[model samples]
Target: MAKGELVQAIRLLTAERDLPMDRIIEAVQEALATTYKRQYGPTPDVRVELDTDSGEFRVYAEKLVVIETQDESHQISLKDAQQYPGEPGLNEMVEVEVTPPNFGRIAAQTAKQTILQRIQEAERDLVYDEYANREGEILNGIIERVEPRGIIVNLGKAEAVLPLQEQVPRERYRITQRLKVYLVKVDRGVRMPQLVVSRAHRGLVRRLLEVEVPEVFNGTVELKAIAREPGSRTKVAVAARQEGIDPVGACVGQHGVRIQNIVNELNGEKIDVVPWDDHTDKFVANALRPAQVIAVLVHDAERRAEVIVPDGQLSLAIGKEGQNARLAAKLTGWKVDIKKESDAGGETQEAPVPPEPVAVAPGLPLDPADEPATMAELLERVPNEGRDEA
Candidate 1:
């Protein structure tokens, strides 16, 4: 870059990165001086300056103008100091310009290296600043590469590492494909800061809803809690500030367009938008959506609950492999145990029935009955009028 180009680049960097201009200028000058000292001998009192307007860099040496020099390397005669237009006191330092001879190949290479290193450092800083405050927010980036452990996404200012654990299982990522991710962390562990991205975090679901639902972005609808099984299902509870506005309906949008969009982004992951309530019973009931809850018995002291569902609705409330009940517990911050009304009602204690002797047919061998027979068999053998006596 030309002298003017260098100055312009520095100015742009300072503005874009929100860095102090003096600090950036000092960084550039220090790098340049380091380059110079590495190639040349221990040059004393070396100073570098870049003209703010012209971008011209000047190298000079400052020396003390002394009547009797104690250190010849750093002190100059009063007459020489006067030549530099400085009123030299008894022991005053005067800056004098130094022009070295034949700084052809070495100077060019040093300057190139200095500029490149400074630019990289500044760029790293800019990237760090841009992403530091983005935790829990959504960002879109291009897929740079897919590694064995994760996918690298190139945000406009920086590249973020999206680890496999943070990604939805079975989601396909193609190079150069643009995708949105949740900013989970900004770690400054290495030379450059790392932007850790996630697709499975609950924040991702919230962010996607915020983008698609205007009411949420406008602060009219608030997301209370979210529970998600990445690539499988998610449940979000929301509340509306204004009366008569259904928070769940608002999030669902027209014909489920809003939720469908988010599902598509998550590779067809299912989502349930439920209304939030301060009452624990109502909240837990909502969390287990698409299932009819007969009653919710909450033990507030222990944060535990017993949810009763109709006998026919038992499987629906418990879900496949108990995922529905599990997510309900997470979303409502309670331990949920679901039971059907018949199961709960029929759990009364009764006297154990005596095992019947295996009947052999005329001395032939007999097969053992599995455990105990059904209650109907025990009641059937009893005479209708003699059951109470038995």
Candidate 2:
């Protein structure tokens, strides 16, 4: 390549890859240095310098000035070194120009492959730095491809992987389909930055709310807790941060437009926006929404609540397969034992001894066949159970 062409090529790369010119120049110098070492012999003292404006390059090799040279490549006799620009003394190191006569041709031959490799590496690092600080932020992406392990999404500047475990169970992905994803993490991969994104994460719900609800985004309302069964349902507890603002109303928007947008984004998942309370009893009652709660008796010692609902509301409170009661427990960070009002009677009932701690691992869903007969039994079977505030 001509002297001016090298500068133009670097300028083109800077614009095309969005990389700093200095970085590309550094990469080119390293590539040329490696080429020099490979073609001649491996040595640690070889350095390549390129003039950024003129785009001319030269190779220099450092040699020790010795009274008598034992190695021709690594040492120069004091008499021979003195013939160069600077007078040399014994045991001093000096650099001498060692540019090969045909180096430009050689550089042209090998520079493209080496330069591309270095550029790709620099691009990966730039992308990793950009996304590392955005771990919890939501990004819009298009489905690029589907593999057995997960779906690949194109997020404009980079491709992100939505692993199977992080994908919503009921959602299907197709090529070119656009959706929003939560950035889970940025992993250092062998070839590029591995962007791990998620569609099923509870954070997705939180971020979507921030986008659709002005009050939540501006901190007039705070999200107290969220309990979600991906692709099934989610319960959000919100509290008013500023007086005169209805947290739930602000989130729901006028005629439910804000919440509905979030629902549509999640592919029609059901969401319950309830008011949060500092009192555990009131919060628990609110969490089990659409079910008329007659009373909530709290046992502070065990973080348990005995909820009593009207007889007609029992089924609604328990919900299909005990989902409502389960989500209520998760949201309030309590062991909720829901019962019919008739069952509670007009007497104080001692909190039943929690059955022997169930050995199930926390967060793992119980098998359908092993599901308990009642909400009380189910809550008792899960250990170390609590809300996921993150």
Candidate 3:
């Protein structure tokens, strides 16, 4: 490139790429030095300087001045060094200009490639710094491609990967689909900064709430805990930071608009916004929502609670597959043993009929009854047994 054009390009790069001019100049100097070494063999003392104003570059070879020259490349006689601008003395170093007559032509051939490579590196660093501090925030992105390893999302300034483990099991992604994702982390990669994002992280829900609820964003509502079964249901326990403000109501918004927006974003994932209570019993009861609890018996030493629900609410309390009770336990940090009120004599008791333990794997349905007996049969037998005992 012409000297004028080179100077203009540097200015354009500084303005367009948001890169400092000095960095580009340094890159050019390094590239030119490399070009010089390529043509004339390796020389450790060779240096290149580029004038910022004129975009003119020159190569200099630094050599030590000696009483008599022995090593031609490294040492120069005081008589020979005296010809340079700076007055030379024995044992002093002098920089001699060694710009080859056709050096500019050769540098031009490779300078563009090297400068572009350096600019790419600088851009990667800029992207990494921009996202390194956003580990917990949310970003809107479009699905770029669905690779076998993960989903690639175009996050405007950078691309992010939603690994298989981080995606919701039930959510399907398509090309060009738009969604909000949680920034899980930033990792240094071979070509660029690797942004790891997530759709199933609980933080996604937390951030979505902050976006939708004014109270949550301003700290008028504090989220105490969250228990989530991605693609299925999530329970959020919230408490008011200020008195007379309803935390649950604020998160739910007017007519449930706030929570609904979050649900829609999550592809219809169910979210339960429950009030947080300092009292363990009340907290546990609130955690198991849509299921009325007759009473709760706390065993503080064991960190367990024996919950008594009406006979009709057993299936509801246990959820379709023990999801309700499991999430309630997770939310309250307690082991919950749910039982029918009839089994507890219709009153709070220290101990109730310990139900038969059934081994159920995660994500599997819970029968709440022994094999060969359907839930209806177990329900019928229970009432009959109660009547017979009476």
Q: Which candidate is the best by TM-score?
A: 2
- Tens-place lDDT per residue, model 3, 88-125, is 88898898888888877776656678678888888888
Candidate 2 root-mean-square deviation in Å: 8.6
- Please list the residue runs of candidate 2 whose C-alpha ends up more than 4 Å from where it truly belongs after superposition: 1-11, 42-44, 51-56, 66-72, 76-91, 348-390
Index of the highest-lDDT prediction: 2
How well does each candidate superpose onto the true structure, as a TM-score?
0.76, 0.81, 0.79
TM-score winner, 1 or 2: 2
Provide backbone clash counts, one per model. Answer: 0, 0, 0
Error of 3 at 343 (Å): 1.6
Off by over 4 Å in 1: 1-28, 35-45, 50-57, 103-105, 189-192, 346-390
> Which TM-score value belongs to model 2?
0.81
Q: Model 3 compared with the native: what TM-score?
A: 0.79
Task: Give the alpha carbon lDDT tens digit for every residue of 17-84 in model 1.
Answer: 66666766777677666665666656677887768897666777778888877765578888667777
87 Cα displacement, candidate 2 (Å): 5.4
Q: Write model 2 residue lDDT over 1-390, tens digit each, in one string.
A: 887787788789889999887887787888889889999998667998887787678899999999888987788899989987768788889898888898877776566676688788889999988897997799999999988757999999999987776778799888999999988667666689878777876778888989999898898998888888888888888888888988888888777788888888888889888877777777778888867777788989998998888799999999999998998887887899988878889743543322111111001121123223443332233322221322
